[model samples]
Target: MLKRKISDYLESYFTPNRREALLITGARQVGKSYAIREFGKSHYSSFIEINLLEDSIARTSISKASNSKDLLLRITAIASQPLIKGKTLIFFDEVQVVPEIVTAIKFLVEEGSYQYVLSGSLLGIGLKRISSMPVGYLTVKEMYPLNLEEFYRACGISDNIFSVLEEAFKAEREIDSIIHRKLMELFRLYLIVGGMPAVVQTYLDTNDIKKVVNKQREILSMYVEDISQYDINNKLYIKDIFNLIPAELNNPNKRFILKNLNENTKFSRLENSFIWIREAGVAIGVYNIEEPKLPLELAKLRNLFKLFSNDVGLLACQYADGIQLRILNNDIDINYGSIYENAVAEELYSHGLKLYYFNSKKQGELDFVIKLDDKILPIEVKSGKNYLRHNALKNVIENKDYEIEKAYVLYNENIKRVGNIVYLPIYLMMFIKNREIENLIWKIDLSSLPQ
Candidate 1:
């Protein structure tokens, strides 16, 4: 698949004048190595890849080297390639295996002379362990599962998909019915396949359900392995937390509760385990955002929060054989609500926002609290048109001063605005970023807006 966007980000770091050491961070098997390699091939004349975990000699060489320059020489010798100045790219894969190697990259970028990319699966864990080092020494690039645009490219759809969407966004017109249908089809597939690189690529080449299942299973298996490597002491607790997500998403509250696992289980008992899961990039905690502003942290819920897995594809697999059918709104509507919320959670997670939710002591619950620009936007997720009764949304609108820019409800239809509330189709949600839905909000004129 063409991951041009991520490559574009990497390009800025490698641009000769804008030289910086790159730290490619993501959950395991999200294609960090493949992306770094692709960038090197396209941008550099000679590329050298160092597998720090697989090669003992290279590890020893790096450790034994007296200084950063000596280490560079040893890496070049092991790669059997000349590390030319400016024209060569050096990739340090699995650099987290040796935390000190990250320190070395900072030295090489500032003191020595080389274009470098460093990547690791347990990158978050390593960073926490190595926190005393300089912070701004390297630029960080996050690689997520292939987003919708990338998924479209990987699926071999004509570039027309993006071009048409861009045109519609620019021209401010309704998309042709055929194009909308096609976009929806690709979107449904994305909901099922998710943006994981291996899963997307598997669907691209084979289009086989079995193959897709195997890839998801493989990625999950690798995560299981990571729990052991990264959290061996609390491995059992971590496994329990991981296994409980599919069940917890089924709950109406969605905020994780240890009691939901066992009536007696306590938060303090699983706090470290949950933190480990977040650090591993396998699951993330969405805190409550009470207001919108520069630092969204001021409005966080200390006790209640929701947890989302890194990829929706794995979450789908954990549920059933034909889970996509649930979206049609059958007798399984309750579970479908959980899945829809999870899907929305995945989209929000992709944007790298500080997520929180809104709720007053006597007021009801809203699905999400997201900050866009200077506005703190309250978002509510509805599985069907029936739930858009706007009880929760109306509560937040009338009672709270809340920066109160505007409110959003993600449901199953075209965009509509009633009073200060805007209703958006769940599919268009993938495009919402920085908490500003203005681009999406404008898609529907507020006058003939839904009530």
Candidate 2:
């Protein structure tokens, strides 16, 4: 079985401190069900799974229940395994088909008889229509596909390599040359293989890129099926936008032009299309910011943005066949700027960073700008050897008004630093952790006020 970081998150945060039920959300095939099952069976004495897709009768049972006790009775009747009080963890799969489960969970949670963990094949707008979604009663945590580190572990990379990599990233030192070459090869393979669990597993089992691409295509088909199921805005709007991601990303500027979706149409008509794709976790949008400054959302030009596929493997599969070989071969002649950017976007996003880019007439475009360590840190993704030739990054750093302290340039090369710019290996993006700033304890004394 593939080791996941979410297991640690469950053990450390959700298991010990779960006052509210947790709903693990992400795109389908991202391994939400597997993670939940693994954790529940290991942690609790009794693990009861209720899959709505398999048992349609549970939907009626969950909806008709009036109170917490009744809801528990209905769920227990449908559960596959024994539901022992206090010792059991009930796992709800494909909950989207049974929206009533969202309402029933609050009552079940209040009753406090058995622990509950819920997940579904789809998220975002799938749950949006829930009129009373037990917002405070249910906490939500998203699970992404196997990220770079998880992929490394799945590929059986050593801890010593990870330790050395972590140390070098922190110290701003070049990785050992031999290890660097091998890791770069692994990183390129990651671009083709991506973090999707099923796809990764296929590659791991067979050691074949052909089988991996086939699995990726199946997931893409599932996404298409999911889009058709929801019919958000218009089915065409969502599907077309999704299909256009690879081509649009290949554009010079990479900003998704609404006009391309419909030549005579306006963004007003197709707004929900983009919203659905984002909410569905089918895509990540890096919006254009008017300036590289604090409070990026306020300065965001929502209409102007770059859209990337949710997973890089799926993105590669969307392109022509045999590109995977080129990537694995470390092909440099091909224009893979979009692929590199997508990997960075997916990595930063997995780290819980909201993405934005800086573009102006005078200063060139920065691939990504994020609020990290309490400042706007611009990121530039380079696929070619000329990683240092970033004019836009220079302009943003040189500009006095932006007050940008430093930036990161990710490439398939060794780590180095020049002045305020930090150049890191693209694979090192695995360590871009999600820090907790919510409980920052800071208080100024007002007792010294002038009397």
Candidate 3:
């Protein structure tokens, strides 16, 4: 069985002490249900599963329940397994089909009969459509395609190796040359097979390229079907944009041009189309930042951005057949820049960073910049031998106006520190994660104010 980091996440999140409803959401085929099922079976005395998409009777019975108690009654009537109070996990899968269930979740949580969990393919869009959102009663965690670290574990790389890599990154030391070459090979394979559970499984099971490509295509088709089924009003624009992502990323600058979809169209006219694909969790949009500074959102130029397929495997599948083979052979003839950028994007996005890149006519462009530990770290993604030649990155760092102390260049190289730049292997992005949590308690000077 393929391992996932989210499995551990589910355990840590739903301890016996914390009573809360949970929602596991991501793009279709990212393995949300499988993770939930495994967690439920292992942790609970009884696991009750309700899949609305496959069970018409269950969908019909529970879709329109009048209240929390009535909903519970309807749920219990069609449950596939026993529901033991305080020891059961009632998983509502494919909940996008019956989103009103979210409206009634607050009352259900208050009732506190069984631990509740929900999952769906397009919860980002479906949850927004709910008339009443259970604001404080529910917790949400988004699942993503497996990152390099999780993929490493699945491939049987030991935990000790991970610790060594972490230590190497922290100390800015080069990995052993032999180990680095082996890892580089593995990382390229990861680009081709990707972290989608099904695709990864196909690779591990048969080690066949044709099977992996076929699986990725099936998923891409399913995404198109999801668009047609869910957003009938704007499926045309959405599909056109979705279909164009591969070609668009291959462009020189890799910034998606709205005109590419339709010569006469403007971003204002086609804004919802972009939003639909993003909300569906089928694509990642990395916005262009006007200035690299704190609060990257404020500097964000929404109209200017790069759109990437949510999974690199799907992106590769969208391309002509030989790209994967080329990637594996380490052929530098094709422009691997877009592939590298997309990999970096998926990694950064999965780790909860808002994707931003700086582009200035005077200063050139930094591939990505993110706020980490309360400061912006400029990033450059290089896939060629000329990894050290980054005029844009150099300009950004030297500009005293920005006061940016450090930056990172993710390349096919070992860890090194030269001046303010930290060069790392691209896979180390699995280690660059959430901003450090701050002390939320802000006690005021009450004595000075009142005395």
Error of 1 at 241 (Å): 0.7
Give the C-alpha lDDT of model 2.
0.87
Q: Which model scores highest in lDDT?
A: 3
lDDT of 1: 0.74
**TM-score of each model, in listed order:** 0.89, 0.95, 0.96
Candidate 1 ranges beyond 4 A from true positions: 156-160, 163-174, 262-265, 289-295, 324-334, 435-451
Ranking by lDDT: 3, 2, 1
RMSD of each: 8.0, 2.5, 1.8
Model 3, CA-based lDDT: 0.89
Model 2, 232-309: lDDT tens digits are 448888999999999999999998988788889988888888888887887998999999998999999988889999
Report the error of model 2 at residue 58, Å: 1.8
- The all-Cα superposition gives candidate 3 an RMSD in Å to the true structure of 1.8
Stretches of candidate 2 off by over 4 Å are 14-17, 434-451
* Alpha-carbon lDDT, every model: 0.74, 0.87, 0.89
Task: Choose 1 or 3, whichever is better by TM-score.
Answer: 3
Candidate 1 on 242-357: residue-level lDDT in tens? 98888888776777877766688777777777888887788878876554444668767665678888887888878877675553224434345666777777677777766776
Per-candidate clash tally: 8, 0, 0
lDDT of 3 at 272: 84
Relative to the unseen true structure, what is the C-alpha lDDT of residue 405 in candidate 2, on a scale of 0 to 100? 90
